[model samples]
Target: MIKDFNEVIKSRRSVRFFLGKNIKTSIVKECIKNATLAPNSSNLQLWEFYHVINDEIKINISKSCFDQPAAKTANQFVVIVTRKDLWKNRRDFNLNFIMNKFKDLKDKKSRRKKKNAVNYYKFLIPTLYGNFLKISGLIKYLNVSILGLFRPMYRQVTSSDLRVVVHKSAALAAQNFMLSMRASGYDTCPMEGFDSVRVKKLLNLPGSAEINMIIGCGLRSEKGIYSEQFRVPFEEVYFEK
Candidate 1:
């Protein structure tokens, strides 16, 4: 078994071709469960994974991706989606978890903890997520930018900024899923080339939900790996301050 995490990470590649053999559903699902453990903003976990197992659906999705070899030849697909509009639902879930957590404790500190947690979900999340014609996010962005001048402030406030934030967290989850698959001796290819609108409709997801990336999963074929890995020199991209 490839026990070394570094080796697993290094071995993972965007395989464009896959073998005819199929992978077990249970194994893929377990890797998806690992994806949920990825760190996310405010513990909201505004991400959803759609595992496409149906023959017709995968083919449809492949076409939506322009019938690229990566998607066309994939045995299955793991579609990562960002659900920023579900913030209220996730916030309430977090509030419930926090409430249940403090119920067993009998201390003033615990009460304070519950109060802060409740306030964050009840007040702060709505303020950050609620928007009208993008004006509210605009105002919030300006306010944060001004506040940041005097002190450290959370400046990511606009709707576009929040979109990026949710997508980033979803991408992190996708990475976790990919790494877990690599460790399990499976291959995956993360592809951004796709018809987002058609994909959303195909998946029956809400319009508010955004497609983060579509990952192709299967066993690599004889010539699946298209090229050797390449990277810029460390000095060009890395800096210590």
Candidate 2:
């Protein structure tokens, strides 16, 4: 049975050890499917998930992760990746999708909406993502800074900034994947302590691709959780307008 949303959130822990019991590959795939529904920047969807089920590959990945207990004991691994290099392809995909959706609408309001969406993918995205050896981004950043002095302007135009944006989206999807796994009566531990170079070579990922996180997945062992959850204090973190 699926779990309630609050229960799923509260129950999730950074499981350090998992039982030898195996989890269903199909169920993990379903959780990944749910992950894709996560909201992203401009709907670019510049992310990929690698479900490492093969024992050989999983072992190599665990080695890359320094064979931490979470990595060594988990039944499987899910690697989330950010593909900032694929911006053009994703831009065209959204462009085509939006165009197709609005193709049949001839009303004035519909046409205006279509034009705005079309221009966003066609013009704005290219301007933001089409950097020439980082020069373009620098120029765009300077331009935005100058314009911002006079009026409110979008500023995060540098290549590094965009990379952060893509990774943030991937991390959001990773959270969704973990929560979905919890809801399905499974567990996961998101691990960043890995050799990105080795993991990329193992996965045959390109240089422009980035490893967001590698999640260890399975049924948590009795001693999987190290300690009770801790927090500074809700009042310290929460604020009101």
How close is every model to the real structure, measured as TM-score?
0.95, 0.98
> Per-residue lDDT of 77-196 in model 1, one digit per residue for the tens?
999999998998899899999988788777889888889889999998888887866588878988998889999998888889899899889999999999999999999999999999
Clashes counted in candidate 1 amount to 0
Q: What 10-residue stretch in candidate 2 is worst by lDDT?
A: 130-139
Q: What is candidate 2's lDDT per residue for 63-178, written digit by digit as tens?
A: 99999999999899999999999999999999989988889997999899999999999999988898766477878989999999999998989989999999999999999999
What is the alpha-carbon lDDT of model 1 when measured against the actual structure? Answer: 0.92
Number of clashing pairs per prediction, in order:
0, 0
Q: Cα RMSD to native, each candidate? A: 1.4, 0.8
Error of 1 at 222 (Å): 3.6
Q: Give the TM-score comparing model 2 with the true structure, all chains together.
A: 0.98
Please give the lDDT score for candidate 2.
0.95
For residue 3, model 1's alpha carbon misses the true position, in angstroms, by: 2.7
Model 2 clash number: 0
Q: What lDDT score belongs to each candidate, Candidate 1 first?
A: 0.92, 0.95
